[model samples]
Target: MIDTGEVRIQLRKGGHLKLERALGARVTSVRGTAWITAERNAGDVVILPGDSFIVPCDKLVLVGPLSGTVTLELQGARDAGSGALTHRRGPIAKLWALV
Candidate 1:
């Protein structure tokens, strides 16, 4: 378990934040709305206040505010080497596993 203090990041309009070498991050929008884009993921995500987004590992993520300034709370990266974590599967794989 990694103990970390809460961090607040402010993003101006059309501003972005680049993160590297992080397993993942738990991000919450405290004020206004934020737009998030990842390396492997297509399209942009809009998160509003009281909402959260997870930034996956091994990818570059860009977070920007849609308008005005957005206040975001970062809870740090995920734990390393936790075997319980698994990749997402398609519907076919899920059905096969049930057999």
Candidate 2:
């Protein structure tokens, strides 16, 4: 198993997402779909677009993938000041938006 202290999340941008750890997130469940995981409290999760993670493990910081040629989109954090939004560019995002 990957140790939480030595764990690193991968994003499609060839960069790492910014995250902070909480003391008692007590995440006991995490749900991942397709290629990515969404916000779930249980350490940190790496995900791609359209992926959803229901973390019931610990207080987790979610990392999503986003690039020019990527699929799936964790756009929940894209609005307001949630930081850099994870968007599945090109045709995928367009199709998802249509749905």
Candidate 3:
């Protein structure tokens, strides 16, 4: 899916952000540098301005800034040609969590 705009984030050096699968975020560095790590994925990724990294939907991810301050643009995944959030039906609690 594609997004026309993006969510912005700012992080200080050595600071981290916890991510959930609901976003399916595609993070693009706007300034400084950032390090990305996924719980179910091996290895770490570093991105500078103009670089982007995709976050998988089935795992947790941590994003940390490597520079004094880093700016990022986050684009969330959604159904193609649709604006609503959609996922497979699961337990009631999990389904309500999306709300």
Candidate 4:
């Protein structure tokens, strides 16, 4: 894919993102919220336990732990490319519980 023009990537809300090794994906980091990063060659599709900052390629420069522990997940909208959100944390069902 070349920069023939301006190609935009969109990620709708509401869905579950399931990442595997084949995608070379993992929980890069997390802070109050979770952060995930997928490889550049990864397919144009992703699922999260909840909402997420769905960035493309290595745009995810920083990913910290959402909670003191680690689970690699958060709740937010899909970031067009490498971005962050301060929404909820943990599974959608147990988000407020975190607080």
Candidate 5:
């Protein structure tokens, strides 16, 4: 969970960060390219420096460096379970379980 202002994070090569229930947050790449994948999303997103992506919903999202080290900035991200829907199981998860 991240506060509203802004938060910066650095990801080493081959390392990743998992963001859960990060709805409406904006991710911006500040350094190297960043690879972003979200649960239920068919395509992955790559953001270069100065680019940004807004989280669509409260789901599991993965962020990492495309190569080498990467720096990212997050804005308007809130704590997990803090959104309107606080249940641990989201609607989709409750409807169907994968594998």
Candidate 6:
């Protein structure tokens, strides 16, 4: 489920998600690998697990899994309350803690 402040999405191989006017939003790869390409950007970015990329401008952005399934966390600029960031546990993190 997507909260008000952030969104978590899982994409299968060959599937993609599009975000429009997502300026300054931070996209983090929680699992697997994904590729990010933004409109007006010169190049595409590949993010592995635990990697994050900040959208540089308000443009159309596409994110897709490079292989297998990919889980992503997107936090918008307004999501940062009082300029402080909060950490949330992903499934992998939770599983790791139980191990």
Query: In TM-score terms, which candidate is top?
Result: 5
Local distance difference test, each candidate = 0.64, 0.30, 0.65, 0.31, 0.72, 0.70
Write down the worst ten-residue block by lDDT for model 2.
1-10
Tens digit of per-residue lDDT, candidate 5, span 1-77:
54446667777887776766767878899999999999999899999999999988678888889999989887774
- Clashing residue pairs, backbone N/CA/C < 3 A, model 5: none
State the TM-score for model 3.
0.68
Quantify how close model 4 is to the true structure by its C-alpha RMSD in Å.
14.0
TM-score of 6: 0.72
**Candidates in order: C-alpha RMSD to true structure:** 13.1, 12.6, 8.0, 14.0, 9.4, 9.0
Residue-level lDDT tens digits of model 4 in 9-88: 22223322333221122332222334344455444432234434434443322343333333343233232332322223
Off by over 4 Å in 4: 1-32, 35-49, 73-99
Off by over 4 Å in 5: 1-3, 77-99
Higher-ranked by lDDT: 2 or 3: 3
The weakest ten consecutive residues by lDDT in model 1 span 87-96
Give the alpha carbon lDDT tens digit for every residue of 31-70 in model 2: 3222223355333454434444442332334444344333
Task: Please give the distance, in angstroms, between residue 68's alpha carbon in candidate 5 and its true position after superposition.
Answer: 0.3
Candidate 2 structure, TM-score to reference: 0.24
In candidate 1, which residue pairs get closer than 3 Å at backbone N, Cα or C atoms, i.e. clash?
none
In every candidate, how many clashes are there? 0, 26, 0, 12, 0, 0
CA displacement after TM-score superposition, residue 47 of candidate 3 (Å): 0.5
- Tens-digit lDDT track for model 3 on 1-99? 544345676778766666655345588999989988888687999999999988765566777788698897766645443322221221122222232
How do all the candidates rank in terms of lDDT, highest first?
5, 6, 3, 1, 4, 2
